[model samples]
Target: HTPGYGSAAKYIGSITKEVIRDGLVYDQQNVTLLEIMGRNAGWLTGAAALAKCEDCEGPDMIFLPEIPFDVENFMKKVEELHKRKKSVVVAISEGVKMADGRYVCELTGTIDYVDAFGHRQLTGTARYLAEKISREVGCKTRAIEFNSLQRCASHIVSRVDITEAFQVGGAAVKAAFEGETGKMIILKRVSDDPYICVTDIYDVHKVANVEKKVPREWINEAGDYVTEEFVSYIKPLIQAELTPIMVDGLPRHLYYTDVEQKQSR
Candidate 1:
């Protein structure tokens, strides 16, 4: 499972506190801005909405790729909020596209790169919007991308996610050991009360390269946010604290030091 969902929520909370700490007053006129990860799936963006709700008890604005994006409509929404509120925090997903069916970032005509898996590399959709909005709205606009940093973070791993990951990995090993060939591990949620998950192996061909997306019901009708029900379903998974190793009164992280050098013959 991609940890991007939990990471998205964590960064949204971080940004909210950062804005408040930086004295970005929230009345009815200003907006706090952020960008999160997602390609075709809005899972990360939806998690950001959940994070925002958990951090602040006010209405927020979010933009996602699930709905056809309209820049003018977006600006209009911001303007409407600015008229009544001193501060507005808008969360946008990186893959968001315009009504004209173009990405604001695509104007750079940037040469795209792909990983071994052949997924297109993405960068800087937030910077484009922030620049555009700053020029058009005449407001202090700050765009922040919680990009790869989300995936790199282990400190914020959802206990549920970590546990699930470990279990899945173990399940994979067990499946292989049992002579169950060509299978991948999957999790089935049995109940929410105890937050139970059952790990089972699935045919590898059935799930490889297939993407599961956040359902429309999981998102608010405005296409910008997630519902409380969605949050409830996700919240327990992220619960439980991870213990950190301390060194000089700060958490310590370990890195590999042993390395083998190739000898030139």
Candidate 2:
């Protein structure tokens, strides 16, 4: 989960908070579900937990692929949250599956194909969960798939992450100049409170293709939410903001597919 993950997560945390603010103003009961992008890793989905703070209530519940999802228990949890608050927000990973390894997307019959990765294509996870919650609770439910918007939202990016991304690339180039082969650049967090961090090189064999999961200790006992430890870890990464390079009030992209299409014609 490198390159664009931190930037996308910053967007996730920001959008989630804004959605919560807008949802609470309504007098009627409703359920809002955000489907985050994460297949095997729940790292992106876990960012939803960062939306919580002194000012924002954040997500009422969060479901990650790391934990087995129980529909009966999920519905009951929603009912309980709805009883306490009119606006109940839930953040779920697109890959959240049951104990038997079946995805919730199967319930809606939305999975019709697989990608080159041989994994089932995920698109309707949020809608499936949304409709299910609507039917069970008889409330107004909305499903928001942060999709490409999460990656493209330049306005919601984190400066710290962008700087680190640049630093990592530079380090990689430096390593190559020194004739270092089979190595990867990794961010080794030196401190958390003051948010001190630095990049370090590691052997690709030791670090590459290895899955570092969100430790169970970082997750709460209920397994539905993350602990403060997780929050503290991500808090620094989201700090600082960057202004996108704009042209005529629009953020300019390095390339536009439409322009290339027109030129081909």
Which model scores highest in TM-score?
2
lDDT of 2 by residue, 1-265 (tens): 3666677888899899999999989999999999988776788889998789889989998888888889889989999988988899999988888889988777787687977657788778889878887888899999999988888887878888889899899999999999999889988888877777787888889975566778888878887988888777787788788887889988876765998989989
Whole-model Cα lDDT per candidate? Answer: 0.68, 0.85
Q: Quote each prediction's TM-score.
A: 0.84, 0.89
Model 2 ranges off by over 4 Å:
205-209, 254-265
- Model 1 spans > 4 angstroms off: 1-8, 11-17, 20-30, 52-55, 254-265
Tens-digit lDDT track for model 1 on 1-265? Answer: 4433444455455554565445345333445666777776666666654544444643367666777777778788887776766666777777777778776567656738878888766667777767777788777667777777766766665666767777878888888889998777778888989888888877889888887777778777877677787777677666764666778987788765445233321
